[model samples]
Target: MAPVPKSMSGILIDAPGGADVLQWKTDLPVPQLQDGEILVRNEFIGINYIDTYFRTGLYKAPFPLVTGKEAGGVVVASSSPEFKEGDRVGYISDHAYAELTALPAAKAVLLPAGITTEQAAASLLQGLTALTFVREAAGIKQELGVSEGPWTLVHAAAGGTGSQLVQILSVMGAKIIGTAGSPEKCELARKNGAQWVIDSRSEDVAARVKEITSGRGVDVIFDGVGKATFDLDLEIIARKGTLIVFGNASGPVDPVNLLRLSPKNIKLMRPVLLSYIVTKEEWRSYATELFDLIAAEKIKIAVFKTYPLSEVRQAHEDLEGRKSTGKLLLKV
Candidate 1:
């Protein structure tokens, strides 16, 4: 087993702003473990758009902050009986932007057989988010009464979460109409299992959705683009359909008019990951399903790019610029 170091290198943001605030520290103290806590020497760090939000102050952070959400690594020390030295693991936490992270034993999952540290680091957080979005937020079971019965639409369909949504919907045999910014993205969405791809840049989303559904509209719409696509989603979403506004890559949505809900019986929801995966049991269940899908070769994780931990700014720039699709990882 590799020896644990007393100090580690990490990225720190003294205040929220752009990625410019992310500074690499050469001699940061390795976190001390409390009882039932495990310390990991991180090998791979997961870069998520949420990190951008925290950096930009869209999401508040107490600084100086180390703002990463997930990472994969090996346990170097543990005060927890549940783990020991050299256990391969992946963990989720808000303050994860470092070479070493201390996690409560309950918040970490041992990498199962046949799953890589890279896959665990990349998949655990986002994959479970996708599973929950499809199974719960979209309410696929309650909405789709028949096998292969429902039609679903996913905005930003070539995105990290959006692609996973398409894959999960395909597994359930649901017809999927996905929207993307360009033709290349449209093709990527199709490969991820979207039956129809809309170039939102060139196509009228509501008109195309109506044309595809023949005016009945879709059973569910996953709207991650926020204000830019909200009006279109409202107009084209089916009567009694659900619209899950899970993200805001464009910008935060405007105030909604509840009066519209009465006319169409539409349901609007904004589901967040932390609320659903709050409990260890809940975490375990979601992780189990996500891992099963991956282990069984049902969900294929796509990493578009990776950066050494030093280039976190570049990773953030690429993600925030809307320049890439699928997940981005950081080599810690």
Candidate 2:
């Protein structure tokens, strides 16, 4: 292998605030490969709302932390038997924001043929998250009593993760009702397989959902937006319905009492994707299923936009502003 660069460019968050806090430094040292680790030359880095949480301190990170975790790249150097030089791969990690970074071999997954670097970057974290939401968290089996399919409410349905959820649930025969803030975003959700898209700007969500479900509410509500939608979700959930609160894009939800769910005997869950993907076996199963859906064109992983590494601040600006739908990537 060629010699590693003395330094590489990356975005760092020195203190939590707005997009301005993203500190871009060109002379960041190239991470060193360690035993059981592989060095990668990143091609695409995905920008997720979780990155925003870390950036704005909704989720804490050590000071001066790198700003992203999702990226697709090719192995340039390897010290692990499981990975070799020249292997195309993608990874999710706290250290993936750089041009070159070291990752544990166990955390890396080889990019299957026909899956491009951009696609892998965009889908691995978000797609697998959506899959686990429908298959595991939503309890689409006996637990939720909707083995074939259920009426699902996906908030922010045109978003990177939400869009993936809509697509996957669409394939699984679910009746999906998606909520978006704008007409365009609503249309995007509809395009990705949502049967009904509600424009939050113009419609009362509870009323619309009740109208659509004829007051029975949906079988499941996948709510990524927290405080802003929590009450509305509870109101629109069906008897014994499941409500999966996955992300806090708008803001953290307020404290809740277990008694709050007694009205309908609703099932409330807070699932973390990181927990589900921690084991290599679980990661592989979800990732394989995600790629298979993509390969068969059953799911479309949307790359809404891309920015050069230098423009990472603008990327963050757009993401935090909710200006882009689907996946946003930084071309590294």
Candidate 3:
């Protein structure tokens, strides 16, 4: 067993700004486990666009807070017997930027052998987010209705959550149309199983989408790139199509009318991951299926960059600047 330390280190959010303000702080308590909880010595923390929001003050925290949300590690202490010391585990929980954190045993999923800590860190949050959006928010149930054509559209296709959603939708027999900023990213999207990739920066998204489906828009459109993509997403969905607006990467959109919702009879939603995986059973079920996808080699984790924990500021900068093609990580 690794020697347990009395204190842990983490990135501190002092004020919101560019990556310049992120600070490394030591001496956070090596949290003691409560019943049903375990202490993990985190090895890697996932870098996400949301972390940039928290860092730049686009999203506010309680102040002087730790900044990361997902990590993979080995359990060193457990009050729950179901998990033991040295178990390879990873989770999506608040405060994961720290070198050590107390996590609920139930919420921490044991990683399979051959899955690196970096891959585990890369998968948890984004994978679960994708799972919830497709399986719940869009009502993509297993039964294939006769009216259902296996077609879906995803924006920001090379992004962390977007790529996972693309893979999941493809494995479920959906013909995927993915949009990205560059031709390189468009090709990456194709490698991830997107049947068609449109360079949204150069092409008319609605026109290309129409061409792909022979003037019929996709059955579902997953839009996370907010204001920049929302209008186009709305314009491209077929009548009665489901449009899920789950994140605001390009900032929030202006208010629209209820009448706008009626024109196509579109089911527009703003989904948060917590809303779908609200219970322990739901988390386990979704997480298990996600792991199975990984284990079966059906979905791949794309980590484009990694930095030492102290460079979290730079990591956030890379993510928010749209310089990262896939997932980023902070090695603890």
Candidate 4:
């Protein structure tokens, strides 16, 4: 094993702003592990939209934060009995833009033999988000009275979390309608298991979805586009359906009028991934199912690009600009 270094390099932001605020430095001190923590030398860092939320001040954090939520790496030091030196793991934790991250043991899972470090980094956060939301948020389960699946709509279907949602919904036998910006992305969404695709930019999304469902509207909608599509979601959701809004790519949704939900008795939810897996048991159960799907080739990971740590600014720009598809990673 390589000896632990006294210092590390990573992107640091002193204040919330735009991509310009992300600064790369080589002299940051290595993080000291607290009890129930493990120190990992990160090989690949997952770049998520939530990272952008923190960078742009939409999601508040203390100044000088090393903003990152997930990474795949090998554990180099452990203060917990559950992990040992050289264990390959993927974890969800803060301060992950760095080459070294001190992770809480409970938020991590040991990488199975068939899963690569890069794959783990790419899929863990988004995959688990899709899995938990479909199971818990939408309640689309065979045992929970959705035996024949539901008519589901996933916005941004070619994007990271969107792709995963499409794939999982397909596995659960849902008839999926996906929306994307372009023809190529629409094709990608189809390949990821969207049975029907809509060109959100040039098409009438509500009309297309209504026609596809034979004027009945979809049973559930997974919308990450926020304000840009929130009203439209209400237009096409079935009575007693669920609307799970999980991101703000086109900006936050304005304050909603609760009276709007009264007509259809629509179930509205705005969920964060962390809230679903607060306990170790919750984390482990979902993570194990996610890895099983990966190993079985039921869920395919699509990495749009892996940027060098220094090019993180460009990466963030591409992500926020909606220029990339699938998962984005940083090579640490």
Candidate 5:
């Protein structure tokens, strides 16, 4: 193995703001390993909406932050007994917008033989999110209870996490209704297994959803569009249904009335991916299942574009502008 470098190039943010805040620097120091941590030479870094939240101070962090949460790379140094110098890994951790990251072994999983580092980077965060949401958040299988699949709705269904949710829900036999901004994205959502696709931009979303479900409303609503769609979710969710609001693509949903949920006996959840996989055991279990699904081709990864580290500003612009579908990645 080659020796690790003393310095590397990465994106840094001095303070909260917009995409302009992401600064590329070539002299950033390679992270020094700590106990229970391993140093990774990142090959690809996953771009997520949460990164924007951190950058804009919506999700507060200290200034001069290295704001990224996930990446896939080869372990170059280890202070953890569970990892070695050449193992391939995908991890969720702070300070990932860099050529190298020192991440806790607890937040990472070993890559199986057939999966490439690129695929690991692409799927780990979003794939596990979809799996956990379906299996636990909505309790899809348990709710089936010997009946036909339940009616489920996914907002922004052609986006990274949304695509994963649609595919997993399809495999679990759920009848999926997906909403995307444009016809192309809506078609992509249908290709990912949405039984019906609504153009949220041009169509009456709530009406289409209600019409498609025969006015029963959907049994499960997976909304990542936050403030823009929360009211619509309330209007269309079925009696005793579950509403899982997981992202803030349109901005955070305002505080709930609680009374809103009472009328329909709705179950409301605002879950974060980190909370679902807190322990090593939990992380590995879901990650294993996620990788298995990918291996079986039950879930397909769609990478919209790969930006060079210096082009991260434009990547953020494109992502925030909603100009791209599927996942955006930064090549490290």
Candidate 6:
């Protein structure tokens, strides 16, 4: 191994506001490890909508905090008995937008053999989110007591997390109807295995869903767009359908009405990934399944763009402008 530095470059959000708050600095220290922790040399970082929230103060974080929540890298130092130096790994953390990171063993997962660092970075946070939504929240099983061709509606179909959900549900033999804002993104959704794609900006989401399902509504809806799409999701859900509200890309939903779901027999939930993986065994199992899907060519991670660490301000601008499709990565 070559000599490693004591510090490296990273992107930081110094205040809540806009793109101006994203600052580039090279003095970020190579994080020190405590017991059961590892020092990693990151190669790639994931850029998602929540990262924008952290940047804009929609989600609170300490000022001057690192801006990424997901990354993949090689472990350079460790005090954990299970991890060794040079082990490839990936994880989601509070602040990971650096060339180096210190992660607790509990928050990290060893990258499966044959999976590239890029794939791991693209998969972990988004893949785990998809798994938690379908398997845990939606209760998607071989038998959910629906018709042979059950439908699942996913908002922001071309996004990192939504793409993963399409892949997962398609593999489970469910018909997936996805909403994207553009024709290009609609094509991307179809290419990623969505059975139907609705241009949410140009089409009536509820009507398109009804047409796709032949006058019946969908079996489940994976809603992350919150205020913009959550109400429409409720309108299109079939009786006893499950509506999983996992994020708020459009903005926070105000005053949820549990009473509205009564007539539809709907199951509404706010699912979180942390709740789904309560133990090391559960994390390993989900990671293993995700890797198996990749290894078997059942899923593909779409890396839409990559920016150098210093250009994260431009990256956030592009993301907020809705110019990005699929996962955006920051290369260290």
Provide the lDDT at 145 for model 1: 29
Q: List the global CA lDDT of all models.
A: 0.86, 0.88, 0.84, 0.93, 0.92, 0.84
**How much is the lDDT of residue 265 in candidate 4?**
98
**Against the hidden true structure, what lDDT does model 5 obtain?**
0.92
Candidate 1 residues lying further than 4 Å off, grouped into runs, are 142-147
Cα-based TM-score, every candidate: 0.96, 0.96, 0.94, 0.98, 0.97, 0.95
lDDT of 6 at 80: 94
Clashes of 6: 0
Candidate 5 error regions (>4 Å): 142-147
Ranking by lDDT: 4, 5, 2, 1, 6, 3
Per-residue error (Å), model 2, residue 115: 0.5
Candidate 2 lDDT, 214-327, residue by residue in tens: 999999999999999999988999999999999998888999999999999999999988888889898877788888889999898889899998788898889878999999
Give RMSD (Å) of candidate 3 vs. truth.
2.2
Error of 4 at 192 (Å): 0.8
lDDT of each residue in 33-134, candidate 3, tens digit only: 788999998999998777877877777887777877789999998899879999989887778888998978878877877677778899988998988888
Clashing pairs in model 6? Answer: none
What is the C-alpha local distance difference test score of candidate 6?
A: 0.84
TM-score of 6: 0.95
Question: Between candidates 4 and 6, which one is better according to lDDT?
Answer: 4
Better of 1 and 5 by TM-score: 5
Name the 10 consecutive residues with the lowest summed lDDT in model 6: 141-150
After the best TM-score superposition of candidate 5, give how far the Cα of residue 295 lies from its true spot, in angstroms. Answer: 0.6
